[model samples]
Target chain A: MSVNTTPMPPERLLQLDDVHVHFSMREGLVRAVNGVSYHVDRGEVLGIVGESGSGKSVTARAIMRLLSKNAIEAGGRIRFRPEPGKEVEISSLPRDGRQVRELRGGHIGMIFQEPMTALSPVHSIGTQIMRTVMLHRRVGKEAARARAIELLERVQLPKPTEMIERYPHQLSGGMRQRAMIALALSCDPALLIADEPTTALDVTTEAQILELLKSLQAEMGMAIVFITHNFGVVADIADRVAVMYLGRIAETGSVDDIFYQPKHPYTRALLQSIPRLGQAPVRRLKTIPGMVPDPFNAPAGCAFHPRCAYAVPGRCDTLVPEVSLFPGDQSARCHLAGELPEEAL
Target chain B: MVGYITKRALWAIPTLVFVSFISFVIIQLPPGDYITAYAAQLRHGGEYLTEAQEAAMRQQYGLNDPILVQYWRWISNILFRGDFGHSLEWNAPVSSLIWERLGLTLAISTLSMVFTWIIAIPVGVYAATRQYSLFDYLFTVFGFLGKGIPDFLLALILMWLGFTWLNMDVGGLLSPRYESAPWTFDKVLNLLSHLWIPVVVLATGGAAGLIRVMRANMLDEMGKPYVETAYAQGLSERQVVWGYPVRVALNPFISTVGWALPALFSGDVITAVVLNLPTTGPLLLQALKMQDMYLAGSFILILSVFTVVGTLVSDVLLAWSDPRIRYA
Candidate 1:
């Protein structure tokens, strides 16, 4: 079959079409990513916001094909645009094949949550960074070394030449993360995946890392799928946001639309939970009532209905909600999407 | 590193002295001297030992000396003259007696160690990578059986099979022709042909235990985030498994090498006896049985030295291999 020859505009760099990831455990099948669909445009920072067990990280790993041994891609596709009008179905690629291998740290790169454990303790930072460079590029040792140093400099790690030879343990958490980012950007990937990259750092270090990522994205014009639980972080860095709840996308819109005009009851509760600056001192901050249901025996119908205060009693608890598209490229998964107020904040 | 090694070597001196002293004390714990056992053997042969002969024996061996004086004499001879004393059982110098059989024992033990590691490493890597698979479960079962069955019993079974089914003589480390022959190429080849019997007998239990240890270590290393990190780096599965987790897994395995070395030389006494191999194990056992204090004590001391040196070598190797274990 001939490929599409038309000079089509590149709208979205990566798209997940109703992807479902399940983990087969001794207890039961865990619905990790249940028909979650979203698209990340070129140079767009798509923030995936969710609490623990909300399947945001799993979704990121699915795109990267870095899920654990137990995980199963039960359904749907992760279609990545290689170039304008050209797409590759990541879900169809073998987990350990050359295609996925090239996709990882080549066309797409990932930086994990814990910088301390993300880099191998035995190898020097330069060697680890050079691994990506050597893997994706056809360069000799000397050239790869030069590129490694250049990447380190790009990540703004102090004394790139000297720091390249140093091990991960020698560097501070912030510096280690900088090195990790250098490793991720070594191949100049079209898309970057940051899975809670700053979760393990101090608040100050987290801000610095966020600043570095923003600058790098702007400099390279690369799309980023940033997974985090912090709404503040999404507000600061994200252009578009996808709010997930119980393995499904509850809402996807512009950051302002989700934060200021949250249609889903769950998103509104999450926004309420964050303590705003200059707010009155209170004994307790707002929290969604119930926990993420046990995945083995997840609640039926609308997963958030149990915890949602504005849940339609019989309707929300009994019937599963469908995606409702609004006028401004915003969508929500709720039965009362039309009836609910546009601005809850 | 040189300073650290020197410190370790210096520390070993007192430790070996204490170990030798303990062996001396323990050897003396048994009732009566070697003469008493000799005299009893004579009685069993229908020849009574008279009071005159008993007195003569006591005077000849300096049995009248105090325990501390005897110990001092023994230790002094070892320290100053480099003599390990005369063996009452063989009536030969301890050093010469050990030296006669040392080569054969070393060859067998070393070969067994090589075999154990060669087989165990790959099997361990396989079992760990294919964890919970049919192959892993089968190896696990075999591992337990190998560990549980006594080495002597296995030796006996192997001997029976070699003799009855294979129609082979599976005793000793040399053929009849090579037993008295010089160390020529043909003699060495003959020795090699017979060497496998004892080596296989010894390595069965060792390789099984080692395989289990290596598999456990690999599993642990595989679970670490570093392994996943390598995978995320776009490394091939082989590269990720061997180059990353297996390298780290080797630390614990290398540390066990010290204990393994001494065990090869001194351990598996029952297996040695059953196979009738001309190694130190049978000699040590006989010395202890006949209350040959000097010979038994020397054997214990040598084994202790092997233990110490083995541990030291493994420690240095571990420090060299694992960056996490840097010595001050």
Candidate 2:
């Protein structure tokens, strides 16, 4: 309960309490997001960092109920709290029900990885954005058009009027991404889920998109769930970071804490693997050994044990580690979170 | 865009020439000329064509000239005089013979095309969106059957059904009273009454094949990220299906228009024979059977023009509908 006096602890915008996502395949069930839990506060950016199969995107899609037909939310809850004590369990709602439809693009918006393919090539940029605006808001066509042009200008796309009439194929990659961002923000959604929005872009363009996103977040005061495989990006934009491995969160903390004082071996290995600029040209980049375990039949205990440099023979191979929280609101799901050596390599 | 269209039009000229040349050469490839076949037919019918008469007929028809000379004569008439020569069997101008049947052929082919697209687009979209559903499976069964069965067989079956159940004539494009009559309301009504059977038979294969193509194209488009982006925008299922994937999927289908022209015509021929419809298909078949090179060549030339024109139209439509293709 928020005390009238205490600065009502910045409202919890969205929360996921131990969510699980499973996809049924002919071969076997893929446990994509296994007991994953995290939350984003108002105006805060939470970066979910993971490899391709690490389930980061799956978690983001789970929040939006955008998983494919074969996917099932095996367990857990995704609760969105618009205000204190007013919660809607996203996991419990029917996938195609009107409630979820209203929640998407009305209260929540998403931008995808590839800008070229994310925007429909057959439609003009203005039409796509205006449709989104009209879908969520009761507005006239002229008003929606004005809002679209405004959003395009806000995203810093040049020639807003002319560009609105042009198709996605006419724009450069960065401009296309800007247009996509404009579409996502047309409704001024409360929560924005960006699934690797800059992965397909060049570094300069990626940085520009990230900068644009940060400024937009500042301007709109909306929470962002930024999913990516790049740690450098997480360090740049995220206030809090959640490092995922094998469909579970291995470590989560403030950006500084996760980068400077990583607790899990996987997180430490990930940090060491980053190719520093000043390193010797002949030296190979340090890589964590062993592949991610097959999802159909994951290892018995710690999923990272096979790849962890400091794996214990008997204990780490058998007993799954429970999430251990540290003093500074940081947590790591590792058996020897505190006892690992300082050096990762 | 005008420049592009002009370029396309200019390109079609050479294509048509090449097609006409090939058709002429292939039609001339058989061992004997129309006179020889005519004499052989007369012999079989217990009559005789004297050698002098055959020789005179050959000379008058330019059959005694070199093959190159004959080709030049044919091509020049088409290119400079706009004349397609005379039909050896029908004893009329090839142009008039073609004109006599062009109306019905175009009507049947056009109607079949319209029927095909009208059925394929929506059903294909449905199958793609609800893949693996019972309706999709059932539709797939129909598609397979439609694709596998020959058009002539389908015509026969439909004709049998119509005669047995509906007591309808089911053959020819018009009733006896309207066969050679002017284009009046009664004739039009009679034509309409008889048109449905051949149209259904002719359209089945194309419609079924197009449904499969459309379904595949739609499935591919559905997997593209733009579709997911549309959904994420909270567009309804109907809006998303129609707006993004359908538009993108239509590219390949539109490109098929060029090929569909020739296919519809050829398919119409067999169906026409089976149903005894008064279309260019039966005329073409008869001309080929009689070794009437000009008549057969004219049919081939007309079909070629339809193909080239169809391709041009499809290209223009593709450019207009898809911005990616347009800019490229």
Candidate 3:
């Protein structure tokens, strides 16, 4: 490994390698994240786009080793390199162990969809943020308080001093989200996992929160795994995009490559379905046909075969397609991704 | 907050008046007055009262007065002078009989109430966090059984069990040896030895109810985003479970405990009788049965006040615990 020769290949903070997360159910097993694999480099934003149950959030929780008790992430390695030379295998650590606790909120932080529910109603915003600061850092109460107020101000929440004394219910939705973001960033984690954080806000508030997050990411110089279903959100903030369908990566590439040159049929169908701003009006927005197959009774091979317009019947219906690699860390889990002529669709 | 409390306290006045009137009327509605029962008792004791003598006795006792006038006198004495009138059967002041047993009743109720929470909260929290585990299922079954069994029946069974297996005296607030003895360390020990049975009997049903309530409450709160948020902050599972969900689950529990305040005087009356405990519950039952109007009325009135006051206290505690409540 001639590592010293080539500008040290921008260090990878987190790399999820062929991870599989399944949940045990009374009826059967739910394969939430099936052979999912991706990575985040230092100070970069990786957008994970998917439907509600497509396992984007599950993947984020897998990286944090915070899956629910019935869930098992036993199949693959979630390697995290928080520092330059050190590596911690997150998937191997016990979900509720002391080691995971030290890793969470210190090396990685997460914010959720609904800020009102995510923030505790009983504790003041300051107490919530300050506790995170104090948990990871050896700081006195006053110092933690100072850091909390600073973080609150950094998120641009008005009235930092007054807001610190206010509970989550006292704030507006945007304000609560800002406070949550402040809490997540309290310990200065190297990576932040924001899982549809703007989904619950009004359009203006969502825009505000996204803008705030973009600015904060720029200022802190930390990697972000932003999970969202909104294509607009992905286009606004993502450097690289991973489009997921039925718990598998459909296509992953640079933002331009995903929007302009989608290789997988699922990704192409998703792009055609959205209502773009300048496009001519149509009778109806194109929606991908067929329901997402139930997790308990997933189809035999390609989970998306029933819905893929370009599915090769025998190939996609029986043999699961391996991820075909491409240039520039891009790939697609479809049998025909690399065939140049099929990219026209 | 002070103003809010003051407003609630003021509302209790008319409520007390209404309660007094209703309880007074209900006590009077029974087939006969206390004197009628007293006359029957005298007849059974081989003392004959002529009709004229009975009339003279009723007039002398002011029983012939209008019911409203009698009610006025009773309520006036209680309000202005703290006089609960007289107990016709006991030939003593109503206050004296009530006071003698009320102190003991309050102590027992408070202890059993504390016991219920101490046992229920942790057990409920544990069952919820370990949802479908062995202890969760066990407590769920135990909770159902405790709720289904009648308090008096449980008391009888426990009494028998204590005597047969433990060879322990299971009845009354004290042993026969310590019944009339002055307060001493040995007497205190004897009292405590007997105290546990009543406490356990009284606590069983309440503890069962609270455990189920707390368990359901914790289950609801545990899955709320805030608990996950706490864990996402890298908190240990213990800290995450105890810090937010447990605290939220206590809202209903504190209210239940507050409602138990009125149970101080009259909870599980039959159980008290079965155990032969010297508490207010049994005394109240006897008073009601004998149509001891003053004594019965006083007991009901006091219990009503306790209930209203208990609700007020619960509201205040809830506000203190949940910041969102202050706005509401």
Candidate 4:
């Protein structure tokens, strides 16, 4: 028998640089996404982690140009190098223009958080999946149906043939999520933006979905932007992690570095807040004190300064910390990050 | 689904009968009596009829019976023999007279409904999609104006325009020339020319109301997450709004179709009189005014049946369209 061989590593896919998305409200301009930058290599899973209102979702929405009318992209660019020779600036693409339409589903597919609301209740799942497949691929109905059934199987949904005929309401939450995944993968997109794909799922289902996504990435060599507030999920699936604090990227590193040696005060505080099984129950868990500042009226210098435990009096409050690269393949935005006293190892 | 329709149809019989009985009682309980009105007219026109003869006429027409008995007899006649009794004033069978007028009214109502849906759906979808734009504002203003003006006033305006400017006759279903013309293409055109005004008057307010409802529903459906999901799927904007949202939003509009039919049909009394259109609405109004109990009561009963049937048909249609809706 001839020897089997592995496929070549896929190329570097998406690079976002200094991306800033703002929303204009009555109070002021809310900087929903501020200077967020990350790159996804082919088949790499990049996780963006933060609490609610930290701009993780906004960053994803900005990438997709799915933000509301009031939202403004103030700065930076999203560059997509589709193949070896082709590259395009995603940020410059008009929202409703033909190029953006071609990019969506054809190049960059997205899976939203809530599967119940994401699938149209009126249409059957087969019709919904067939629509995207036929529209993007110019495939005939018979071939699209075969592809949709294949996708349903790839996402690990049971009874693929029968499930395709059912409505969204007929499926369970986990199954609906899987169906959404199948829809996203219908076009065989290069970059898959999963915005809290597993957030609404139960713990067991979440673990299964994560495994399925990991396996699919291995098979297809698709880059993924996995946005979530759950650090545990990031720890489980992400090759690299980006921590967002009030729209800005507070820290960026490999998963191991960010979890064990988080340098930014906000990142450290976020990790501490995850209740461990061995930790004793307390009256209140180790929550970072104070709420995230209103994005419309974000602080002048460090947005997280008010809530930071190790905040320097004037340094943290008045001067914006530059994102500085550290020694161990990590970067952080904090005035005294490198100079902090080392804890006993 | 067949079982559901059967159950609904079975339930509708009692409801229709109850409505007919109530309509009969309410129309009869009013001040004037059909026999009295007929006798007074005869006396005024120099006809010699004795009081005994009038009493005999009342007995012959079953007017001497108690209110409940008369209602029972009327309902029984309709149920068993399909008889609506004879008109005291016109001396014609109620069924034939009512049927003639009912056909005209129904034709106008059907045409108006067709026009209303054709205009309203597209305008509504456009308005909702282009919300806050100049076209939306202009259509919204027109919608409000159409709804604000009464149907009769609209008819009066059309009459004035047609009579003074175009020198068009403002009466009947067609010109006198076409009344004797053979059933040909030219006669159909003549009939349609006379049919235009009443259809427009009846349909304009309905179209305006439907557009408002359709616009609101379309807007609400557009904001739903599924719509955004459609867009995110790389489907065209047209597909997102029309393909998905329109079908979902149409449930409410479909259900409203039944109620709109009867209202549009029977609600045209004033408009009918203003245009001198010999439709059921004006006929029913004349019947009531002359206290021709059999004619008026039969017309009321027919109107009630139409209302009930309209609602039932809509409910069944909605259930058929949406699996989520059940008719238990």
Considering every candidate listed, which one attains the maximal TM-score? 3
Scored against the true structure, residue B158 in model 4 reaches a CA lDDT of 86
- Per-model TM-score of chain B: 0.87, 0.88, 0.90, 0.88
Which has the greatest lDDT?
A: 2
Tens digits of lDDT, candidate 2, A71-127 = 988888787865455668788898878888888888888999999889998999999
How would you encode candidate 3's per-residue C-alpha lDDT over A58-175 as one tens digit per residue? 9998988878889977587777877788878788787789888998998899999999899998899999998889999979999999999999999999889888999999899999
Cα lDDT of candidate 2 equals 0.87
lDDT of 4 by residue, B1-328 (tens): 7888888899998998789878888777767677677777788989866889878988898888888898888778888998998898788999888777777777887888899889889999999999989999988998999899998899888878988998987667788888778889987887887888888987888889888998999998888878877888877788788888998889998887788767755757888888788788888888888778788877777778878999999989987876556422
Clashes in candidate 1: how many? Answer: 0
Q: Who is ahead in lDDT, 1 or 3?
A: 3
TM agreement with the true structure for every prediction: 0.90, 0.89, 0.93, 0.90
Clashing pairs in 4: none
Query: Candidate 3 — which residues are off by over 4 angstroms?
Result: A1-10, A280-284, A340-345, B31-72
**Worst 10-residue stretch by lDDT in candidate 2 chain B?**
B260-269
- Model 3 in CAPRI terms: which quality? medium
Can you give the lDDT of residue A264 in candidate 2?
A: 96
iRMS, all models: 1.3, 0.9, 0.6, 1.3
All candidates: CA RMSD (Å): 3.7, 4.0, 3.2, 5.2
lDDT of 3 by residue, B1-328 (tens): 6776677778878987888888778778878776787788899999987889888888987889998887887788888998987898798999999989888888888898889878888999989988989999999999999999998999889899989999988799788888889999998988898888889987888889888988899999988999888999999988888888988888887665567888877967999999998899999899878778778888988888888888888888887788888655
